[model samples]
Target: MRNVSINQLDDTPRKVVALGTDYSHGHLLPFHTHRRAQLLYGATGVMQVRTSDGNWVVPPQRAVWIPPGVAHEVLMLGVSTRSLYIEPGAVDLGQRCQVISVSPLMRHLLMEAVAAPLMYDRVGRDGALFDLLLHELTRSEVLPLHIPMPAEGKLLSLCQTFLNKPNAHQSPQYWAEQIHISLRTFNRLFRQQTGLSFRQWRQQACVVLALARLAEGEAVTRIALDFGYESPAAFSTMFRRVLGQAPSVWLEAAK
Candidate 1:
């Protein structure tokens, strides 16, 4: 198996490895792609991957499927992550990348795959293992954590800046002016490109930040205040609206 630098990874066949490890680095890898599909899951820690498609956060309950040869990067707490890589042609797994929730059966299968003996020479076992992994993957749920990318170029840049900061709420008109476009044009273009209004986009970003904070076990009051809510109650209301549950409930489920 050839281990190339992350920059050298592309959508081509080389050495495909089912690599597993726990890492807590904030940004796991730079924007990159490889010829093999990657199944990134962390059963014990917080993990999130950002691709051009959107953000895929791997909670203990889920796994992220990265299609073969797609240029994507990951970011999260670098602690313990169980990442697996499979070649499109090598394994009977799909080339389409996505995020899937982890079932107890799937988690147990993953553990077995990683624990296989290095000298295990049973092709039957290997094939069975890969097939089981693929089966588990087929049952994965595409999480909403993957917010689609905005196509309005200038507006997209503006949105990205806000997303990166994630601490301040930018008005749509302000973003429009910053992008040298009128407020009306900005709204029109955003809806045309992303199927979401400016407000929806911002809310998604805010929710992503909130999820990160929640994963860290941050206090609800402080997290809400940091995100510019006047009070925790308001923030909780908004959270329930977007997430279909209160922050505490969601966190409890995650825990």
Candidate 2:
């Protein structure tokens, strides 16, 4: 659908509108906002979503909740998506965007919702399906797949660079000096802007990026060495520390 048509549907009285779309690897949607909140589910591949507030990664069978009017952009990594444009006030999702798990039932509901009439009978099967969809959304589990970016331009740039070549071994002093700030001030500002300490942020970034590489069939040992870990065991330990599961188990769940 065209951007203008999408904007027109923002406040429909129907309460919910489901749209299905697909993109090839590396497709990018530039920064944009919608009048309605969105649940963007990736049925086949991963998505990297970025807003000024932070960055989030959504892998296959996962989704992201974007509150109404929040400007964001999405990059598709071989994705097929089912997106729900929910009228404002239809659900009670908080303001920030978050990555959420998609249950098997939720997956089927989304496929059904998109195939039904756009203005299905209020008391009919389509309406019932959407009601169930909303209920399931309320109970969906939030995933630790977000990497919050700092607001400051220089620091945010530094963080972005680190994401391209994430190294968990990088010291606080190294990062602080790269940004030309004292270690104490850097630590304070980093937490102030991103709500995470430097070390915590780095680990989260690595984990999210690691998910993409793992999906692409990269060996765990290569990923470990590329990301500066001493060994695959070390990488597994760090991944478990942040995600509560070993890499293999986590990838299986994501698959």
Candidate 3:
């Protein structure tokens, strides 16, 4: 099923349909919906997934779980993907979209699953492989790679603007003034709407955004300064805090 579109085999009558596809750098998959839940794995490069509710960044060797009927758009940055389109009732990863860390065994299973037939045997080796893959999926760790969007009118607009040009130094007071609210009210509202404090949300957004640039080969120093960090060391500190590894180490592992 390499390089095949899921639309052509969505009704295969199987519990899961696997497809492997390669995308050129900067390729965009316009907004689309699937009848089955999707486990979209990026074997290389990075992926940016966006829906009405939020944006998720999937780095190399990781995957994003998309529930059925969720309209989403994907920006593929040099990604080679292994996708599992599962019957909604067959697995329950979750309702919301999330980036998950793919274990080595799960990665191997994905590679083999994509190579199996579209209608693989139900009681054969391929079937067993697919079964284990689903089990591994349930055990996969959920990463903190989601940037939820706010729904309030003023707050949404402000957040959108900030995403376009994220500045780490942007203070909560600045957003409060822009929305004509006091700092206290703004902080409370931001947490209520996005489920994250202003500082936490800002840092997460910057880290997620920086991941794409870093994957595209942008120098860390430049990205750090551009994002308003005082130094590359300072930027790496924050990146490690959120992601559990330094940028260079993370990049190496991703490679």
Best-performing candidate as measured by TM-score: 3
Question: What is the full ranking by TM-score, best candidate first?
Answer: 3, 2, 1
RMSD per prediction, one decimal?
Answer: 4.3, 2.1, 1.0
Worst ten-residue run, lDDT, model 3? Answer: 246-255
Tens digits of per-residue lDDT for model 3 on 1-255? Answer: 899878798989899989999999999999999999999999998999999888998989999999999999999999999999999899898789999989999999999998998889989999999999999999999998899999769999988998899899999999999989999999999999999999999999999999888888999999999999999999999999999999889888777
Return the lDDT, model 3, position 195.
Answer: 96
Per-prediction count of colliding residue pairs?
A: 11, 0, 0
Which stretches of model 2 miss by more than 4 angstroms? 1-12
Write the number of the candidate with greater TM-score, choosing between 1 and 2.
2
Candidates ranked, most accurate by lDDT first: 3, 2, 1
Q: Best lDDT goes to which candidate? A: 3
lDDT of each: 0.67, 0.88, 0.93
User: All candidates' TM-scores?
Assistant: 0.79, 0.93, 0.98
lDDT of candidate 1 over 29-56, digit per residue (tens): 7788765667777766677677665565
Prediction 2 global C-alpha lDDT: 0.88
Candidate 2 TM-score versus the reference: 0.93
Tens-place lDDT per residue, model 2, 131-250, is 999999999999898999878788988998998889879988998999788999999999998898999998999999998888777899999999999999999999999989998998
